[model samples]
Target: MDSDWRMWSRRDLLAEGMGRRGIQHAVEDGWLVRARRDRYLASTAPAELIRAVRVGGRLTCLALLRLLDVFVLTGGGLHVHMPPNASRMRSPSDRATPLAGRGSREVVLHWVPLLRSLGADDPRVHLVDALAHAVCCQPARHAVATLDNALHRGLVGEPEIAEVFAALPSKYRIVRALLDRRAESGTESLMRLMVRAAGATYDLQVVIDGVGRVDLLVDGWLVIECDSEEFHSSWHQQLKDRRRDLALAQRGYVTWRVTAAQIMYQPEEVAAGLRGLLAARRGGR
Candidate 1:
């Protein structure tokens, strides 16, 4: 099997008993490619990594988080991390020419300093550094969800979170209080934020009499199920959603099944619907 894509610098290759000529031969054979001036990466590495290097920086921000299997609020383009003093960067798709002022839509360049040193030869940014960058890159609510996702996945510990905060400005310190490790998914985390933003109090991962465990329970009568965006979503949803809703309904609990899209894009409408429902419940009494 191929190695774990550990960076192979020129010196590393030489130390591994491979001659300069052998290295060139491997490159010619398409077995390896020079990722940077003196660094090498296996051709079998993920295309995104290769492209990030081609774009003149390390894969970072949401791109790195996604590669680490951590959750991100949204997706688009290649997020490349350039040095704070980096200049004359190349395009994400075309490295031959220098990128214009700022960057292109296809490549979002984060010209920020790293909190932790991601080695010079590494093609990806460090996790804590990426999370910090993500917090700056995304909106406040989405940033909290991203952090919650990192915690939910157990990707970082206290030290790592501390490092991430050290990298961010003071304004983001408030977000530290919003994290919820109990959040099973980014969608669920975002849903919880929506509840808080709507001035509603809720219990997380609460078990009702017959509804099993729920994402969020508001006012002891509402169950909000955050249907995260996942592959086979419809199929997985059909497995238990209606059954859970029916069971909750029978027990006098109202199940509000919130789709990922609605929570992510149309949050105001969801909050309004929530308020309307809650007010109606109060009025009925």
Candidate 2:
């Protein structure tokens, strides 16, 4: 499949001199799927590319980060970049499907010009540009999560990010500076960002004897572990976590576990609890 043509509009085919009937023929022959009103996807197109086109925008921000295998807090909905002058723009509410109820595929639009540098092989915004857009458009912690994963994957480096930061608005520059590649998941990155923003000192992925690597070590003795469903869904995994916590306790580290729910739905409460713990630790010391 030509990567660029894997997901495209009817106009793209018409521009190539293939009339409307040609597109219809391809659909009938099972070569294409009508992804949305005007968007079409090759039968073999990647899900992300299909989603990008279906949303009437290029895949970008967290969407591109997902394709790069970077850690992004999932379920924030589809991220797409639509050119300001693009035709047939509609609000997300108007685009919802009744059969799907609220719809799992809610689209988040980033209004911007299409980057000219995007290669023919990609239906998404170029990585650097997407990262820049992500940093500017998302909350600082969420943006940092994407940056951390990009760095971890070796998809981007500090220098490229620095260059991107140079062009970003002043508010997002601080998030770029705070990006730490050591974060293994979006949850950990976000929690760490919140802790720091709340004026506490912490270290990420800190190694302790007999405890493997803990997620975040704050104020010297408190260990914070960000637990996703992947870590805690099984009884066996819960037993292992308990054992790890016991080991850390024996070694003079206090282990605290945070869940995806607390991170997503109760961030302020999470911050408050972290602050209380840090304050208590300081008082004890």
Candidate 3:
């Protein structure tokens, strides 16, 4: 048997050298199970391997994203992007069938020339590949995470990120904002954006009467503290945060402490609460 036939099926082997009669004999002898037209798998093959062989290599972006653990919203179909000028051949076993209706469209296909240099085994390269195709992303935090991952994994450096930022179009304000505030902590940067978006005019890292440097001071009335898991992970840091909040409260400032999760996942709720506090202060004044 040819070396390539090891990865091929009995029918492929027959096509290469063995006749159709040999393939039929092999099937009858329980050496292979016919999975599809011109396709066969050994009976001892693992279920996953068999399934992969049957479906071909048509895994879409969504499935791959889930496997990569990237945050993705529901409802969008799978998208697979290839490199420009590369062969756009669909595997024979790809089973990602199209739906029938408005939302029943098949997975999307994108061609990016940069993908040619990427290695499939490297996850950081895969994430960069995915980000290259992302048109719009909400809450700037996601981009921050991707950037942080790229940096932390050594896939890209600070200079590279800066270069990409400089090349972006002027209309991409959100992207620019994210690039400008690319802090070491994604949660901190996200919270800062959320507060700014909510129109909470504040001084960052402001000094107060009693408290030392605080995260934000809104009109000298509200002190907003963004607690990230990385910085405030230990009990000592948690106690320090509480003490700072109490000291600020004693100094006539209403301290509002928000966690990373609140900023990343529940921005609207936090914004509403801040708005209520600001309105109450305005009414009292």
Q: Which candidate ranks first by lDDT, i.e. highest?
A: 1
Regions of model 1 farther than 4 Å from truth = 1-4, 84-88, 229-239
1-285 per-residue lDDT for model 2 (tens digits)? 464345566788789787999999989998887766766768787676666665556778776777667766645567777766655543333334322322245766777554446643356787887888777657777788888878877888878788678777787767877888998877788898878877888998888877798899987888999998976989999999999999998989888999977986789999999888877877885
Q: How much is the lDDT of residue 228 in candidate 1?
A: 60
lDDT of 1 by residue, 29-146 (tens): 9998775556577888877787787667788888888777787767577889887766657665555667676776678988877777755557888888889888887888888888
Full-model lDDT, candidate 2:
0.75
Return the candidate ranking by lDDT, descending: 1, 2, 3
- Name the runs in model 2 displaced over 4 angstroms: 1-24, 34-40, 46-48, 51-57, 66-69, 73-116
Q: How close is candidate 3 to the true structure, as a TM-score?
A: 0.53
What is the Å distance of residue 46 in model 2 from its true position? 4.5
Which digits, one per residue and each the tens of the lDDT, describe model 3 over residues 1-285?
222122355545766786888778867997765544445666654333333233332222343444444433333444544344533233323434322221123445544344324333111224444554442333345565555544544656666665445444555446644543334345545556666676767666676766787767787688777787878889999898889878877778787878877866787898788778877887995
lDDT of model 1, residue 149: 82
Model 3 regions more than 4 Å off: 1-80, 85-109, 115-158, 165-170, 182-184, 203-213, 228-240
Model 3 steric clash pairs: 55-93, 55-94, 56-93
The alpha-carbon RMSD values of the candidates against the true structure, listed in the order shown, are 2.7, 5.0, 8.6
Span of ten consecutive residues with least summed lDDT in model 2:
94-103
Q: Estimate each model's TM-score.
A: 0.88, 0.77, 0.53
